[model samples]
Target: MDKKLLEVLACPVSHGQLFFHSQTNELFCPASGLAYPIDAGIPVLLEAQARPLTEEEKQA
Candidate 1:
């Protein structure tokens, strides 16, 4: 993810900062407990597209 783009991107739900998970190619929103997927280098920010984090994922 580009630093500039990451800096400006926020969770669609909580509007909080997102943490990038490179392994999963997703943007995680700690506040909303959601992981928004990144496809083809673009973030899919739709609520329906987000996956809820598992407990293990939350701890990571």
Candidate 2:
């Protein structure tokens, strides 16, 4: 992912900072406990498309 793009991207729900998870190719919002999927290198930032993070994921 492009650093510039990532810098400008925020969680749709909380409008908070997001961390990129390379293993799952997802963008995670710590504040919201949601993970937005990155499909074909494009982030699916829609709230409807986001998935709640598991307990393990939140810990990670």
Top candidate (lDDT): 1
Model 2: residues with Cα > 4 Å off, grouped in runs:
none
Shift of residue 11 alpha carbon in model 1, Å: 0.3
lDDT of 1 by residue, 1-60 (tens): 988999999998999999999999999998999999999999999999999999999887
TM-score of every prediction relative to native: 0.94, 0.92
- State the RMSD for candidate 2: 0.8
Model 1 root mean square deviation, Cα atoms? 0.7
Question: What lDDT would each prediction earn against the true structure?
Answer: 0.94, 0.93
lDDT per residue as tens, model 2, 1-60? 888999999888899999999989999998999999999999999989999999889888
Error of 2 at 48 (Å): 0.9
Summing lDDT over every window of 10 consecutive residues in candidate 2, give the lowest-scoring window. Answer: 9-18
TM-score of 2: 0.92
Q: List the residue pairs that clash in candidate 2.
A: none
RMSD of each: 0.7, 0.8
Q: Which number leads on TM-score? A: 1
